[model samples]
Target chain A: MSTRELKHAGLNLQQTDPKTHEEAESRVFGFWVFLMSDAVLFALLFATYGVMLSGTAGGPGTQNVYEMKSAFIETLLLLSSSFTFGMASLAMKYEGKASRISVWLAVTLILGLGFLGMEMHDFVKMIGEGATPERSGFLSSFFALVSTHGLHVLGGSIWIVVMLVQLSVFGVTPAVKTRILRLGLFWHFLDIIWVGIFTIVYLQGLTP
Target chain B: MNQEDRAEYRRELRSYIIGLIAALVLTAASFATVHWRLFSAPTGILIAIYLLALVQIIAHFRYFLHIDLRKSARDDLQLILFSTMIVLLMVGGTLIVLFNLKSRMF
Candidate 1:
């Protein structure tokens, strides 16, 4: 297929040789499927959180525990990380030097770590205030949903580090290229989930 | 990279920039709507917030995920839509049944 014809979901795979390109195409598609299933998992968690919103059992509720400023900052961090990951993908595709890709990925990793730190801080403050997950169903579900997303960010950060090492060792082979593309999808996907969390958990919590 | 590749790089870069700007705007607006009490009622604020979030999600899907209605991208789109449907069914049913039972018991 021509380059134009090879242009499809996730990332463009046409930069590789034909054999590797074909392999990467299916692999990226499979990753997309995995992402969708993961979406369903998050959706269920969201639903559970929604159901338990009223079950605070006299513990700290949304307004009492959530700080909008912190959540907003976290949102900014994750969103910027998503954009940075996009730049990494671009560097992978267009730039000859692997250093460019590594730079972008490093920036993204920092942003991801920043997000995790802020979220953990929020959790720490909430728990310090006696809003532990064991305190109520609401807090339990809230922790479950938000922490799952946080763990995903943590996992993505580790993947970013691994990809950095792979880039040094493999030097942007078709395999490494496809892996980075999949990483981009995962990173961006986490940002999308954060959008949901800030909207439903944070914004909705502060609505009243 | 060659000139054409550089041009393509700029194009993709533009998409990411656009996505970032759109997401920032949406997120800021959502927070501002609540912080400033833009809407007098809680329901109004919730609706406005959710609508903005929906738009931002679509923006992420388009620019970040590279999902569109193009023929080449349709398969992934279809999978996402299908997953969304299943999610709605499962989550919606859970809510409906649980809330119904809660009302009956209490």
Candidate 2:
């Protein structure tokens, strides 16, 4: 690969030859592959959920533990945050405004934290009501599926913070810019998974 | 990226927001339908509602997530479709097999 190719691959997209786009393209391509791999992990968890769905041992089934109103509110927050994050990415990459991107990122981060806060409260309430993960196999799967998502959101929240700090220090450097792009993908991808969780794990659990 | 493109992008964002709200409402209605027994229906109707909500979820992905097949990386959609098929088989097949086995063997 020429210096031009290496540059687009996160070396210097702003100044390099446009034909050297494979590096930037490859970064996204690699991320898509990673997303598919993640789908496999989710598939496994989903299967596990299906298999153990009836193993509730008559102890507070999904309907008993799941709170639709709270979940609805949580869904609203995350979905809106995903939208805002998309706007931040647009501002950063397309609009090329450092401060505008930062503002959007801040909003996204606060919404994410709010979702996490509410989820934590839900979990505490579940356990307090004796529906802890150890209560049954189904509970175990439920906690696994939902908390895995919660942890991912928490990680994404940290990532956004770091990116903001980098933005202030580096001022939209290509590296930071590329990272924000990937993070946008990551954030939105989590919201997509939450759509599944809210439907299958939360809603179906409430079903007879 | 310019004034017109920015306007177009905002339009898309607004649509995404609208779809997101619809998905949320549909999901909530589905949940409440089952929990409070909001209507007179059997499991079949509930299952249909569930399927409808799932469609809305896919809608969210299409409009909000923007995961079109064209933008997918090489073989990503192929693998997802294949894996989804396998997931369907494993989940559905097991439900049938185990229920049958539970009845006969037990």
Candidate 3:
């Protein structure tokens, strides 16, 4: 009759032990594992950085034109978006209000879009400034590494829009719930990678 | 879960937020030195910032991730350690190969 007694009884049914929320929690665990794997991809890039840093040749080095202020703005935008995503996930889980969850997701999507747009703009400006990948080995690797990340963010934003559409038409069925659960891990994982970029590429690029 | 456990989770969440913010601030400060030169060699400063940034990233994994180092159970810790080792081998191995090729080629 009591809560403890109920839980103990619930445990007897292994299949029914975990509620939908409990199922969702395990997805988070799986996502963490995925992030660890993705970290390896980044580690490869970092190693590349270590190797090719001095390969910049006599061409324009990082500071010859990496606008620190612009980089800062981009960093702030991405970091703030990460917080917005946290808010969205929390709203979805705790509030269980469909409309509000969508609203938070929309807000998160907008911020995410803004971050990627700025990055794209930055890439164009860099190229226009004659800092294209063909200029040097360093530039080639920089473009490859940084642009891959931007593309990932772009992909994630598109996925968000698709999920929003799903939530409205189908409502939060078990499938939709599980998808959101996995996406939460993914969105946060990207944010973690962004933090790495903001530090290694954006911050370090300004030095010297 | 019990009230005590929920409260502990909340505390953990707060600590993660604090740590993340501090990392962000230090990260920004490290590079915001564009207006002034704290170090003479750009290469040295760049490497220093990169190393620091890596530390900040691992900090996020530890706190926000809840991947406890103390794995009284086999599943979580074993998975994490195995994955980490594999990743390290791949990345470190790639670095050696690529850099050597880079040295020889161009």
| The best candidate in terms of TM-score | 1
Ranking by lDDT: 1, 2, 3
CAPRI band for model 3: acceptable
Task: List TM-score per model, in order.
Answer: 0.96, 0.83, 0.77
Model 1 docking category:
high
Model 3 chain A lowest lDDT segment of ten? A6-15
Model 1: how far residue A33 lies from native, Å: 1.0
What TM-score does model 2 score on chain A?
0.91
Q: Fill in the DockQ of model 2.
A: 0.33
Model 2 pairs whose backbones collide: none
Question: Which of 1 and 3 is ahead in TM-score?
Answer: 1
- C-alpha lDDT (0 to 100) for residue A162 of candidate 1: 98
Candidate 2, B7-73: lDDT as tens digits: 6557656666776667667766666676677656657546756676677666665665554455333
True lDDT of residue A113, candidate 1? 95
Q: What's the TM for model 1?
A: 0.96
- In order, the interface RMSDs are 1.4, 5.6, 6.1
Give every collision pair in model 1: none
Q: If you assessed candidate 2 against the hidden native complex, which CAPRI class would it receive? A: acceptable
The candidates' DockQ values read: 0.80, 0.33, 0.34
